[model samples]
Structure formats: structure tokens, C-alpha cells
Target: MLQTESEINMFNASLKGKLENLSLSSFRDLTILNLSNNALHGTIPSHIGSLTKLGILDLSMNQFFGALPLLLGNLKKLTTIYIYEIGIAGTIPQVIGYLKNLLDLVLSNNFLTSSISLTIGNLTKLTSLYIHKNNISSSIPQEMELGNLKNLIDLHVSSNLLTGSIPPTIGNLTKLTSLYIHRNSISGSIPQEMGHLTNLIDLAMSYNLLSGSIPSTLGNLTKLTTLHMGENKVSSFILQELVSSNLQTSLIPPTIGNLTKLTSLYIHRNNISGSIPHEMGHLKNLT
Candidate 1:
């Protein structure tokens, strides 16, 4: 229970029972509230919206139900929100764009449905956005405003029902180091613009309808250590222009030999033909 004039600005506990009785609203000065991994049941109390000073709110791994309240926009200072795996259903609210200070949004493994809100483009400061393993059934935004998140370093939207080809504008996220969009219904060829992500370390796009040959631009990602593009419609002649080796007629381009840092490469379950290039010997780090 909150005491009068309590100086506890941050609250984290496994307490059970409805949140309304906690009178969280009275703790006007609260900055962080975490009630995750508890037996707490009931809708997230609207009083949480009153905690304007809050910077982080975590209510994941509980029994909470119902949609996220639109009042959440009132928490203008919030930077991080973790509400995954609590069984919350409904589309992410459009008002969420109001949280200009938000830097991380983790809503994976939920029942969230429908398309992603275009308003998300307003959050230019976001660095990590994880919405994978959900029921979201929409094609990746074709306008590709997500490229506006210049600070984005991690983006995961795998294990959903997404479709459509990757937008060439995705190259605009030059700061990305990890990108995962596997296990979806996404089709079409890999965008040459993908070569722009030179900082990528992990790229997974398997178990989808992706077709066409692997873009040689991927060779530009010298920092990449993990690349999984299996179970797709990709053909032979992968990465033909990836290196200066200029070796042609090989199924797996010798240019692949240039990725010395590659540790895990999963290019199975495809229509690939010809012999595995001997150049693979260069990947001494492969495990």
C-alpha cells in the first residue's frame, strides 16, 4: 500500500489482486511501475495513465485482459513499455504515437491483430521495435515510413501473417544491426536496397515465399555473422557479384568466401543446385 508522502518513486513487486485498490494514481510522483510475472488479474487500471512522470511501465506475464487504454497517450514521458504475454487483444492504439519519448516498444507474443498503425512513423527516436510472434496480419507498410526511425538498431516482425515484398526504402534504416522477418507469408524478391544495411550482424528471412536470386548487395554486410534464408523460393547463383573474385558459373558464388565472419549459415530447403562452393572453407568460424 502506498503511504502518505511516500518517497518510493519506483515500485516493483509480485503482489496479487486488482490494481484499482492500489490507488496508483495517488502516487503522482512515481516514475517506474513494474508488476510483471505475477498472478495479478484484471484489466490494467486506467489510473496508470495518470502517472505522467512514468518513464517505464511493465505489466507483462500476468492475467490482464482487454485492450490498451487510449489514455496511455497521457504518459508523455514514457520511454519503454513491456506488456507482452498478458493476453491483451486488440489493435495497437493509434494514439500511441503521442509518446514521443518512447525508445523501445516490446509487444511481441501477444494477440494483437490488424495492420500496424501508420502513426508509428511519428516515433522517430525509437531504437528497438519488437512485434514478432503475434497475430498481426498485414503486409509490411509499402510506403516504408519505418525508415524514418533513423536510430533503429533492431527490428523483429517474424512469425506473423505478413505478406508482400520488402520495400526498397528499408535501406534507409542504415543503423540497423539486426533484422528478422521470417516465418511469414511474405513473397517477392529481395530488394537490392537491402545492401545499404552495412551494419547488419543478423538477418533471418526463412520460411516464407521469398523468390528470386539472393541479391549480391548482401555481401556488403561484412559484419554479418548469422544469415538464415532457408525454406524459400530462392534459386542458384546466389551472391554472384558479392565479391571481386569475378568467378561465374558457380551455384554458390565464390564471393560467399568473403564472409569470413559468418558463423551460422542456413540456406537449406531451397531450389539451389550445383556443388557447395569450396570457398566455404574460408568461413573458419562456421559452427
Candidate 2:
């Protein structure tokens, strides 16, 4: 067989020049192993579980420290695992719940702390789960199970320290589209089943400690375009029923000029008063 495919491409170019000779026995038939951004330090070579046909494993921005590598769950055809800004600390490796064909699992800005492991709901073919700036705390592991992730799409667990609330089954992620649970310490309310996420478009729950009101069924997410519920303690008639449901474009409140396709409004500090809506000086895409 052409000299066994030229001895497996000269043994993967002599195991990429022995990676400065830390030699973990010549990476058995390696398959797509990028030593990401290299300054490669130690650990990570439980002989990489003998490479069982690895399918893309980036040791992200290295300085690679410890943990991670329960033989990488023996790489069951792993699909994209970038160990973000590596300096990999502990936890995160209940054998990566055996990789179940993972799809983009970037362990963001690592130094990984704890929580987050109900075996990651067995990965059911996950789709983009960046573990945002770790140091992870509790709440958000109610046995984890993301109803088979129906092809999940972009779910960043924002700056950790994660507390509770906001998981009304995450509206079962109906193919979620960008949902970042902001700076954690999360309290309750705001989960009227996330208005059933009608294919959301960027919904960030600001600096947690969330209180009640603000779910006028999220105006049924008319495909929201970035709706960040600022600082929390929600109310004001649920922000006037989310500006009478115009969904977004403007509506920071001058009674949201009845949302004539709002164009970016923030409603600073709160105790919002009256009188600014001269029909918002006629939209004209507000200043």
C-alpha cells in the first residue's frame, strides 16, 4: 500500500519535530492535531488517548497546564475542541462525557473552575458551547440535559460565578441564536419560558440578580436584534410591554414612541419619568 502511505507520512513528519521533544511516543496515527498558538508547556499527553482518529483538536493558545485529558474521552471522532486561552486548570473532563461527536466546544478563556458537568447532557451533538471566561460557580446544572440540543446554536455561558434562575428549560433552545447569560450571580423571574425563543437574535440578561416582570412573552421574540435587559430589577409595566411589542429597533422608552421600528434606545438609570415622546420627534431613526 505504497509503503503504508509512506509510513504514515513519515510518521506525521516525525511527530511535528518531536514538539520540542516532549515525546509522548510519536502520536499514534494522529488526525488533525493543531498545537494552537503554541508556547506549549506541559501536560495534555495521556498519549492523547492514542489518537483514536481525532477529528480536530486545537490545544488553544498554549501554556498548557494540567487536567483535561481523561484521554479526551478516547476521542470518539471529536469535532472541534479549542481549549481557549489555555492554561487549563481542573474539573471539565468527566471524560468530556465521551465526546459524543461534539461540535465546537471551546473551553473559553480557560483556567476552568467547576460546576457545568451534568456530563454536559451527553453532548447530543452540541453546537457551539463556549465556556465563557471561567471560574464557574453553581446553579445551571439541574442535571443539565439540553433536550438533545436540537442542533444548538451559540450558547455562551457568560463570565462565570453562575448562580441560579433563567433556566426555564431555556425554552428548550429551539435552535437558539445567540443567548449569553450575562455576568452571573443570576437570581429569578424573566423566564416566562423565554417567550419560547422564536429563533432569538442576541438576548443578554445583564448583570444578574434579576427580579420580576419583563416577559410580556418577550413580545414573542419577534426575532429580537440584541435585547439586553440592563442592570436588572425589572418592571415599569414590563418596560411598557416591551415598547408595545415592536420587538426592537429602538424603544428605550419615550413610551418607545410606540416602537415605530426603534433604532437604539437605552433608558439609562431608571425611575423613568414622562414627557419625552413628542412621538419621539418622528422616528427618523432617532439620534
Per-prediction TM-score: 0.89, 0.33
- Residue-wise C-alpha lDDT for candidate 2, range 1-287, written one tens digit per residue: 11221122221122222233555346556667666664667767777777778677777776767778687788788888888886778878777867888889999888788787777888878888998888888677652475556677898988889998876777877788888978888887877777787787777777787876676666666555556667766664533233222122333444434444444556555543444656566545534
Cα-based lDDT at residue 29, candidate 2: 60
Give the range of the ten consecutive residues with the poorest summed lDDT in model 2: 1-10
Instruction: Give lDDT: candidate 2, residue 209.
Output: 78
Query: Which residue pairs collide, candidate 2?
Result: 18-21, 249-262, 249-263, 250-262, 250-263, 253-256
User: Which sections of candidate 1 miss by over 4 Å?
Assistant: 1-12, 240-250, 269-276
Task: State the lDDT of candidate 1 residue by residue for 132-220, as single tens digits.
Answer: 98888888876546777778899999998898888888898999999999899999988999999999988888788887766878879
